[model samples]
Target: MARMRIQDIAAEAAVSPSTVSKFINGHYDAMSASTRSRIAEIIERTGYRPSSVARNLRLDRSRMIGVILADIRNPYSSAMLGELADRSAAAGYTLTCAISGNNPSKEAEAVMRLAEAGADGLIVNTCGGNDELLADTCDRAPVVLLDRDVPGASIDLVTSDNGCLVAALLQEVMRDGVDACWLLDEHNDASSVRRERTATFERGLRSACARGGCIALARNACAAAAQLTKMSCSSGGSPIGLIAINGLVFERLVEALAVAGIDVPGAARIATIDEYPWNRVLFGGVTTAAQDIAGLAAAALELLIERIERGRGPCGSRRRIEIPGNIIARRSTRTDSGPTTTTPQPLRAHR
Candidate 1:
């Protein structure tokens, strides 16, 4: 029995070593479909998987990446980290993941510890309020900003393009016959400039829809569903629509709705940004603006690897990549059977 190698696989597949390397690294944009298929077949037939020890030795590098999360328990963060790790493994890199539990000080501490341990590169979904420290760390090594973005920091970012997506979501909801809508969120979360900018868009759009104006509303997210249910009742006692600011709020709203025994697409047409595996099946699929998780993960890795292997990037240009979100309509936000635009639209569709 002998060992298999990338060069051997490259030869077997009749492709250049670099091309095989790209395939292995999950960089297939430049590779043709036939070539990709052929490589995939050869790899499958040969049971060829990269050897980490050999890879590290050949590259003469650690081949380890650091991933810092604001809250690992958050579905969004967990999903992204899983995708990032899967992509990293495909590229022969190992990951060291740290969770900050949404604490700024803990985030800073975790990042510092990871850096001190000598990770080849770093990717972070930052907790708010640690700009200067992160900037300093970026000066020393390649850093990729994931999910959350910092203001005035020169780093590559991969996140959803929120402006148009939020507008589109609102349009779809309006078209679905939601007369009124409420933006549900904790409101006190310390969003970076990026998150705040998106929130501003959501607030503005929601305000315009609700009162023909955007006014600051006191946010009590945990109890939003009950309050909105109370406020939305018409002269005939009907339910209005609710939009969760993100998945976190969505969960809270769902719980509130359940405890209150109100039905979705019945009492309220519900939707939110961010996606998770359970979401598609939850309540016959929940309406959401789901971002391309795999694409975001690959793009983040590409930026990190470029910096790690190529030294400094272009003289002065910083990379900001925004992937658009997709509209997912489900039972949660569908038009009720009777009069599409009038009355409470009671949660009749599901129950």
Candidate 2:
């Protein structure tokens, strides 16, 4: 029982060693269909597994991609990670994942550890506070940011278009007798996607001759709940719209509304960004803006692979990709008008 190398596999397929190596590494541009099939058949029949370590040593690439998520408990994070894993494997790469739990210190540690481990590149859903470390790491490896973007980091970013979707949702809510809207967010940090959505909501309210404000649910859900209650009461019985920044905040707002005996579409209307399974079942199907999880994963992978295959470009010319999300109008924000659902659209990448 001896090990088979690339030369043996190439000999059986009647191809050169470089061709077999290219096949293993997924470089099929110059390869023909019949040649690919013959090589694949031989490799499958011989059970020839390529040695990743040896290949990496020769190629100077680990074939390992590092992924950092702020929190995996959130449905969007889990879904996006699953998509990334599947796509990475098909592209002949493995993924090493880390959860920062939204702690800056933990996130910094993960970034350094991954870089030291010789990861070919990194796809980070940053929690902020690591701009300096992230920027410095760019000199060592290619980095593609996911979800939240970090300022001053010159890294390629792939994120959902928050402002446009929020404006569309606000327009729908205003038609449902919602004179005042409240933006509920768990954090006010730069890492939070709430920043863009909150700004868009405010502008939408002002344009429509409506009023609204932001409530910081930062580390104190109870205080936020009380503030919401007070705001609702002082509105003089006018219907108020409540917009949760993400799924985590949406869950808390739902619980708080139930405890306060407030009814959806009756006492106050409620909706949120980031669609989840629970959202479709709660409160007669909650209204939501669903980000294209698949698109985000694919775009991020494309950017990382490009940088890995090619060399780094000018930092000032870094790419920033924004994928549009769909708005699902359900009963939560329902009025006399019928429910509607918007179709998901293609993405736009900017530099």
Candidate 3:
């Protein structure tokens, strides 16, 4: 069968191709209800699918954006990407995703590929080491950094407030009067988010020490687990609390703790930065700083559109949007309260 075209649909409906084009583009302000109904019926009967490529070319724009993520394996990054796609589609734009796998060379290559493919804009969750390449890319297209920031890059950014999130989590741990606190990270120099998280953890620890609480930092999950085991064995059983920087760090910590036969709220307490469905099911529940996924998506899209419409030139001023996350209280950190079950909630997405 021959592929249907806009002219074919217009001819069958007895309307001009321009009218059909306007209807397809959703410009129905001055269109009559009868005409609109006729076009809709004709389109359904003919099973016509509009050519996005042709329409985009006619507009002299690609109407497509690229989203470069540091690691698609991370639950937080995955959730944010899903929200961005939904919100971008609602705004009549399409999204293409690229994963850098936390490598600087891979990240630079992804940026170049997306630009070569004629993407109108880019939203990136940076891998923390692509400063020069990212700066150059911003000169070629509108780029919005998300979740992580690249230093010396003069692009708009959307991320959660790191300082506030850590402070809130620390407040809960200190209030419970845990014996010792530990901060766990997979590697020290992975991404900007992890760096900021580590800095905040140190500041929180200083504050906790001022209040007379013991605190320490672990280079890797294995080291953290070793320390937990040593403390548990030496003290003949004392309560130790740990704050895992992110989901990956949390997983390693859980595995190590399980291997050592550590009990939650009995031998140790756990808190993490981001929470997903599995976290809730694992130890009954875990406390976390849930990132504002929808807010970040909305901010990223608005920034990208603003830059694209502003035309070719340096941004008038650097814009940084910090979306505040919420602290989810659960059974992992609860001492006197025993294990309690809470209904599993679906993650929120951008509209």
Which window of 10 residues has the lowest lDDT sum in candidate 3?
A: 342-351
Number of backbone clashes in candidate 3:
0
User: Rank by lDDT, descending?
Assistant: 2, 3, 1
Per-residue lDDT over 207-275 for candidate 2, one digit per residue giving the tens place of the 0 to 100 score: 888777777654455665677788789779987888888888887887788666778878788888887
Residue 246 alpha-carbon offset, candidate 3, angstroms: 0.5
lDDT of each: 0.71, 0.84, 0.77
* Local error of candidate 2 at residue 249 (angstroms): 0.6
**What TM-score against the true fold does each predicted structure earn?**
0.73, 0.86, 0.79
Query: Positional deviation of 242 in candidate 3, in angstroms?
Result: 0.2
Superposed on all Cα atoms, model 2 deviates from the true structure by an RMSD in Å of 3.7
Ranking by TM-score: 2, 3, 1
Best by lDDT: 2
- Tell me the lDDT of candidate 2: 0.84
Question: Model 1, 175-203: lDDT tens per residue?
Answer: 44556655665555656623543465557
Which candidate gets the maximum TM-score versus the true structure? 2
lDDT of 3 by residue, 4-27 (tens): 898998888898999999999899
Ten contiguous residues minimizing lDDT sum, candidate 1: 342-351
Better of 2 and 3 by lDDT: 2
What's the C-alpha lDDT at position 287 in model 3? 79
